[model samples]
Target: MTDESLVRACQTGDREAFSALYDRYIKKIYTYVYYKTHHKETAEDLTAKTFIKALEHIDSCDPDQRFGAWLYRIARNTVIDHYRTARPALEIDDAWDIPDTSDIARDADARQRLAAVRAEVQALPSVQRDILMLRLWEGLSYQEIAQIVQKSEGHCKVIFSRAIRQLRAANALAAFLIILYATHSI
Candidate 1:
């Protein structure tokens, strides 16, 4: 069933619908949280909290609206709340695990480049950085990002482009690394 249909069923008190929604979004939400927290445990905790909040407030969801965006907005807010309560050090884990057959030299190079890009991305304004992460890391479209960020689609696109240009200007290597990282070809 479509998300809208599932949401409508959830509103009518169908637990299965909510389960389905959770199943569909769990990995994506976890990844989003993981990227922000950069710690497996915190990401898992925040992701659970996000889902709990979503379930508690499911009645607020409009079936006509995109459920994915609504879920993401919840996750974004949850992360904001977490930061407000506790400013913990971020652990920058390797973005991807290397396969056994991968070259050790290439893997080392990729990790160094990814570290540089991560630093550059963190320096961007929150909105722009979020736009970049949502667009690239999550592979979300501008429309979805706009809804999650409560901005216009065009504005999100412009912000993403500007952020990319800024990154390119600051460190050309960082910009290239981000693209490769996004495509998982690093």
Candidate 2:
């Protein structure tokens, strides 16, 4: 079912509809949260809380608003709140989403490259990092990111561009591979 139809159904207490929405977004939401928390259990906990909160406030959702965008907004707020109450989050691990290789040298090289990229990306200003993550990792559109970040679509594009440029300027190879890994389009 379309997200609009599913959302309407969910708002009207259709548990099945809500489940569909949950299933559609679970992985993307988990990835975004996991990248932020860097702890599997904490990411899982936050992901559940985000969904529960969404169910509680489904009525307030605009049927026309992109459901993914709304869902991400909730997830973002949940992460922010957790950080406020919790200790400083550790930097995201380099191999957080990397698949292991049988070739030890290749695996070591990949991890080292990923670590270099991660350090630079993590060093970016928060807004830039968020823009990069949503655009690249989450595969969200500029419009969806703008909605979630409360920025204009044009501004979102500019931020993403600047982020890419910053990474490239730091180290071309790491930046290239990081961008490649982060994006499906490129």
Candidate 3:
């Protein structure tokens, strides 16, 4: 069923409809949260909180609004609140069990570059960074980003265009996945 149909069913108290909605959005929401926090456990917790809050307030949701937009707004606010409430309350273990020493030097260099690029992206203004995250990471369309960020589609396109230009100018082409596409060394 369409999200709208599911939403209407949910409004009418259909458990199955709510379940479908949760299934549809959970991964995307988790990915969005993970990219922000860079911690698996926190992302999972926030994703759960987002859906719980969504369920709590679903009745007040406007059926005319895009479901993804509404859900993401909740997620964004939740993240903001989490940051406000506490600062790194927990340390998540990210140790890898497998010892993949196939290319230790190359892997370390790649990780350093990735960290630098992430730092650059984070330095961008919130909207530009969000546009890049929603577009590049989540593979969300400009229209979807427009709704999620509450901006005009044209404005979102412009912001995305500028973000790419900025990244390229700053030699952060690693983020643009130019590993093999670049003709000259970046």
Q: Which 10-residue window of candidate 2 scores lowest in summed lDDT?
A: 97-106
Which residue pairs collide in model 2, if any?
none
lDDT of 3 by residue, 1-186 (tens): 988889899999999999999999999898887666555677788899999999999998888889999999898778767755653563321111112332212234434545657555654666787789898878899999999989999999999898888877787556466757667664
Error of 2 at 27 (Å): 1.2
Q: For residues 1-186, could you state the per-residue lDDT of candidate 2 as single tens digits?
A: 899999999888899999999999999888888766655777788899999999999999998988888998898888777765543453323223223342212234434555656666656776787888788877878988999888999999998999888877887676567777886645
Q: Sort the predicted structures by TM-score, highest score first.
A: 1, 3, 2
What TM-score would every model get versus the actual structure?
0.79, 0.76, 0.78
Clash-forming residue pairs, model 3: none
Candidate 1 global Cα RMSD: 7.9
Q: How accurate locally, in lDDT, is each candidate?
A: 0.79, 0.77, 0.75
Candidate 2 or 3, higher TM-score?
Answer: 3
- How far is 81's C-alpha from truth in model 1 (Å)? 0.5
Runs in model 3 with CA error above 4 Å?
87-113, 172-186
Give the winner by TM-score.
1
